[model samples]
Target: MLVLMLSLVLSDSLVLADSLALADSLALADSLALADSLTLTDSLALVLCDSLMLWLVEELSLADVLSLSLALTLCDSLTLAELL
Candidate 1:
């Protein structure tokens, strides 16, 4: 009877060890999935930032062109006034 009790205890400990290992594996998988998701999010953010910068550059270029044209018109008017 004592031997049977010892066997039962050993088997219970083994089962406990297996459950702990399974829990650790599940936790590690969850962490890996989170890391992958974060990486994807970062990539998308970078793309959005790049597109916004391009749009801003285009807007600035348009403003620059308008300013240049205005300056040229002022210069022409001044030249005509001096001639008159």
Candidate 2:
């Protein structure tokens, strides 16, 4: 009968819609998971970079202090020689 055929078509359409929705949900979940992992990786890289920068800054500061001390000693010696 025509009514029976129409009912069958409607049921098939509903099933197809449900399948598409489920597929979309799965795809969204996968995308979110990938984004979270990338964020974590970026955060870890940033932490490592920050530590490296701090270490380099400390080393450079130490070298600067040593150079300044040497310069001050040389200036004092020159002054003393001139006075003598």
Candidate 3:
């Protein structure tokens, strides 16, 4: 579970990296699916995505490796695109 969470974080951190739109959308979709599928009450993925969403609004920025730690820190409330 931890590995899955970490990988998802790392993967999302890679989005908004100036990549091709198709690739970005696909990646975002995959992350979204994973986040949606998680059944845990804590739903760390959701929390991470929430923080990421918050950061996105603040910075209007997305960079590889950006906002990963921020999401990880809010491990309990994360949902899909937690920051968004």
Candidate 4:
């Protein structure tokens, strides 16, 4: 009877050990997946920032050209008034 009790306890301990190992493996997998997702998110954010900078530069250049044209037009009108 004592032998049987000891065998039962040993078997239960083995099962518990197996379950703990499985839980650890699952936790590691979840951690790796989260790291990969964070990396992907960082890459996407960098791409969006680059696109925004390009658009801003284009808009600034366009505004500069329009202002230059307006200044030239004003100078021409002033010269015409002086001649008249």
- Estimate the TM-score of every prediction: 0.45, 0.44, 0.29, 0.44
Over 4 Å off in model 4, which ranges? Answer: 40-84
Output the worst ten-in-a-row residue range by lDDT, candidate 4. Answer: 75-84
Q: How displaced is residue 54 in candidate 1, in Å?
A: 44
Candidate 3, residues 1-84, lDDT tens digits: the string is 999999998888676454677687999999789767776664655565566567656655555335555555455464454544
Task: Quote the RMSD, in angstroms, for model 3.
Answer: 16.0
What are the runs in model 1 whose C-alpha is more than 4 Å off? 39-84
* Local error of candidate 4 at residue 72 (angstroms): 58
Put down candidate 1 lDDT per residue, 1-84, tens digits, no spaces.
999999999999999999999999999998678558665645454454445446556666777656644554354333322422
Model 3, C-alpha of 43: deviation from truth (Å):
4.2
**Better structure of 2 and 3 per lDDT:** 3
TM-score of 2: 0.44
- When summed lDDT is taken over every stretch of 10 residues in candidate 3, the lowest stretch is 75-84
lDDT (Cα, 0-100) at 43 in candidate 3: 66
CA-lDDT, candidates in order: 0.62, 0.63, 0.63, 0.61
Worst 10 residues of 2 by lDDT: 75-84
- What's the lDDT for candidate 4? 0.61
Cα deviation in Å at residue 5, candidate 3? 45
